[model samples]
Target: MSLIRSLRLDPLPVVTTARVELRPPIASDYEQWATLRGESRDFLTPWEPTWPGDDLTRNAFRHRLRRYAREAREDIGYTLFLFGRADGALLGGVTLSGVRRGVTQSCALGYWMGQRHAGRGLMTEAVRGIAVHVFETMRLHRMEAACLPSNEASKAVLRKAGFSEEGLARQYLRINGQWRDHLLFAMLASDPRPRA
Candidate 1:
């Protein structure tokens, strides 16, 4: 028999915070997601990678769901959509990718907030809630995030979520078709949780 055991999150996950709920995206979310992304295109494009021509289409969403499912099945990543708890509005998304096991026991974090929800502190709450699931439930050691030096709002969110700025990376990622430098940050499981 093989020694490897499955790490599949069979039922997926739904994480709740004070103001938001984080859950996996579903087929029914395509309309809301596409509308929100379409409206926020200008506001988000500067900080995000270039989008494909058909990125907002239902077919693209189906492909995205397929990829997410494969990642979850292989225990490589988790992607959750953030929604307003009271109104059930889709506000943004968070992804924990590049999940490393064995000696590393870590993952990379990425998030995006809709234009309407920017500066609301909801993303911070979602990040903290996901951190709890990552460290306590998934038993991971560290979560790392990197953002452009000019993204002050993102930096603030990470800081409020208890991540400590580590250093700078040269051309860490491609944003808006350009390779950009990024400020790195990390939060350890052993670190004390930030109080609200």
Candidate 2:
């Protein structure tokens, strides 16, 4: 993409809440992102996609930027970095992916928080911001989140963000070392919105 095109396609602007900021990851984030993953390898390995040995390389971050920019231009996946507004520290990220419009305007939600950031209700608040953007701003009718049946933390975030447990999906996705079943949760436009 040309510089002008890239500028025009700048990932969606920052989304902020009283305690958090959802922004796109920049090149400068490489170091901290690398360090975070390095230290949290054990903490995140079970739930995350398989990470290759080279995933932390600088070039990997470059590829991620390109993917984020492309996804933004296509309105497919707007991945945002989560931050603690009080100190502007990187908390983790939230994403609205698989966006589908027309007769059914809907998408899926996925997120992760740094180890230290878990259980703090930060991801819950961030999910609320994401819900508002996808449902109200983008006019999407439904937003879905499914997590491994064992992920109580994620289930709590989904429920706290106003999604109701829909059911279980077998082999919903592959994570870490194998295919995993997920518990489906969804928040339709008709569902009560979480207080932001």
Candidate 1: lDDT over CA atoms? 0.93
Best by lDDT: 1
Kindly state the number of residue pairs that clash in model 1: 0
Candidate 1 residue lDDT tens string, 73-119: 77789899999999999999999999998999999999999999998
Whole-model lDDT for model 2 versus the true structure? Answer: 0.86
* Tens digits of lDDT, candidate 2, 1-196: 4555556633385888889999889999888888877887888898888998899999988999999988878777888889899997888888888989789799999998889778889999999887877777788899988899888898888888899999999988989979899999999988887685
Query: What TM-scores do the predictions have?
Result: 0.96, 0.92
In order, what lDDT does every prediction score? 0.93, 0.86
Q: At residue 143, what lDDT does model 2 achieve?
A: 93
Candidate with the greatest TM-score versus the true structure: 1
The 10 consecutive residues of candidate 2 with the worst lDDT sum are 2-11
